[model samples]
Target chain A: MTGLRLAAVLLAVFAASFALAQGDPRRSGYREMGPALQKMQDDDAANPAMLFVQAGAAAWAEKAAAGKSCADCHGDATASMKGVAARYPAFSAEAGKPIDLEGRINLCRTTHQQAEALAPESDGLLALSAYVALQSRGQPIAPPDDARLSNLRAEGAELYKRRQGQLNLSCANCHDDHAGRKLAGATIPQGHPTGYPIYRLEWQALGSLKRRLRNCVIGMRAEPWSYDAADYLALESFLMQRAKGMAMDAPGVRP
Target chain B: MSRALAALLLLLPGAAVAQQDSMPSLTGKPGDPARGRAIVANRTVGLCLLCHGAPIPEERFQGNLAPSLAGAGSRATPDQLRLRVADAARLNPDTIMPPYYRVDGLTRVARSFQGKTILTAEQIEDVVAYLASLKD
Candidate 1:
């Protein structure tokens, strides 16, 4: 009974903050909203995810381990790559495991490119995978309609809702409960993936959507996924889909 | 924390130069680039040299985050630079640069210095003046 009351009080405080954020004048949004919205309706390249596409083009064209190219195996990405990035974080029957974009890309690198997989968080891996994610920018994120993904989504939601860290926060705590409220003197933006693989000034580099998610988890003081694995991407898929229509902010700048 | 950090950061310029007080007050004084250079070198209060590669007079412990401010007087207007310095994250929310002025709600620093300056408004203006003094 005591615990329930505490939960109720906390929920009310969080709700108060949420109520305050509605149409608050202090909430500064991205500067490129007008042009950004226009482009989202037009060229696929204009999609912020296109930064990854550009990066993908470069990675695909660069000479590889076999003195061949990803383009050599799959030419003119427009047709061959269309909708490929959409159904990612999919399950792989061969490995008897689920896989994300990076996983699928690395799988091809080993089988087709005859190359070693890039270690997670390494520049080549992130850049290459980010490039690939761009191809499916406008497509609805439909993780291969499978039982595996359903299970992963449930697990991910549990992880998001669990409280962690000295701050006693969860991913949902600030994002879902008190999103847009002032915290530690800064307004908390709605935690969304509309803009990602963004250039974070704090990090001084372009980072993947997963990297941002991991940073949030770390901020929550929970043990983050040590590897850029399939499980995490499934969670990323769930989160990003929830934030659909929010806009892809690839190559974006964030606090 | 703010008071101690401010004093410590200010002491840096004195440590870099052979003579103390040779570098005049950071504020007031028509904003000298030469003095700004020294402050940057000292990695003290102005610590501008720490993150940028200007006419670096001494050390290189500066961060690689921000671009060099050399010839910034001619490149970007003083107002633009002023806004960037006031709160770089406001301009580029992701910037690692600290706002030398404008302490609306900083909570980490000492209680005695709660509303105190992070490089006074005058000092920030002077830093702008000093930066603007450097041309071509």
Candidate 2:
């Protein structure tokens, strides 16, 4: 080929790749992890998140002061909770807003079990959420099609694009504009929320999606919203809806 | 140096402190290019390689999020380089690059990172010197 033709071909290739990075065909963070981490996530025996799941199992059976364990109301989580996590950040008419899987667990604690709410990212909370989420592993994410969620979900979509912090970056700047690109040694995943209560290698423990969101806000050098902030639920609602139909990989291992 | 000591030094007579401005040396002395290069190459500390590609061959994976550092010296003056390293937001508020020498005006910074800039004034000078040396 002539020099001009060769240049044209290279430009087309570059443009195509850039488009692919910015557009979807969405991928899970799991697809971006290294083989070792992938193996760690795949093997139930090796996944560190399972430790929290085990703890959650114990909590599920233990009766609260009101003499009701989660088991009493829900029964055998393996049967009762399957696919439940996939539909979370569900609308709660009692609270008059959406609530994440963690929030739902807390709601159950206060109302059904007559137990005190677990602190955000607390060991007990992580364990219980992880356990509940594990039941939905591999199920396709199916956000509720409720109209009450529309406004909050829109606010979340706005927040995702709005830039803030010392870095002046929006979630879309890195996760969408430059997804699949390198951020030093790390590959920037597309910021999907398929997994929750994941075992982050950096954290060396199981943590909720809210914890990850808080970390990202800090990374952007922005003030993180409080744990119970409507913004967290809004973002969660938006992310689940955005990731609708993707497989749930809760209690996931990540680096 | 300990951050506490660095903080102490900034309070001393000749620190030349300010997140804005391009004229003054942050440490009031010419930075060592060798030291600057080391900081740029460090993944956990400097994190420069996380966004900008430099001519550091030993580093297996350099970033592609920003312009290559290959001709940075040829492209910008030492003062301009210092300003960009210290606080690029002054030039472009929407830039994704963090303010390496800025400490004030940030909201709700984490406990560990609170009251701390991403890079110290001395380190900013060092990074400037290193970028200045990359003429090619």
The per-candidate count of clashes, in order, stands at: 12, 0
Of the true interface contacts, each candidate retains a share of: 0.00, 0.53
Colliding residue pairs in candidate 2: none
Best by TM-score: 2
Summed over model 2, clashes come to 0
Candidate 1 residue spans exceeding 4 A from truth: A1-55, A228-231, A244-251, B1-136
The interface root-mean-square deviations, each candidate in sequence, come to 13.5, 2.8
Tens digits of per-residue lDDT for model 1, A89-150: 67778657777667787887887788898776667776776666555555544455578767
Q: Among these predicted structures, which one has the highest lDDT?
A: 2
- What lDDT would candidate 2 get against the real structure? 0.86
The i-RMS of candidate 1 is: 13.5
* Cand. 1: chain B TM-score: 0.63
lDDT of 1 by residue, B7-83 (tens): 98898876754232122334444655565556555554665654466666455444443567778888856666666
What is the two-chain DockQ of model 2? 0.31
lDDT of candidate 2 at residue A145, scale 0 to 100: 94
By summed lDDT, the worst window of 10 consecutive residues in model 2 chain A runs over: A161-170
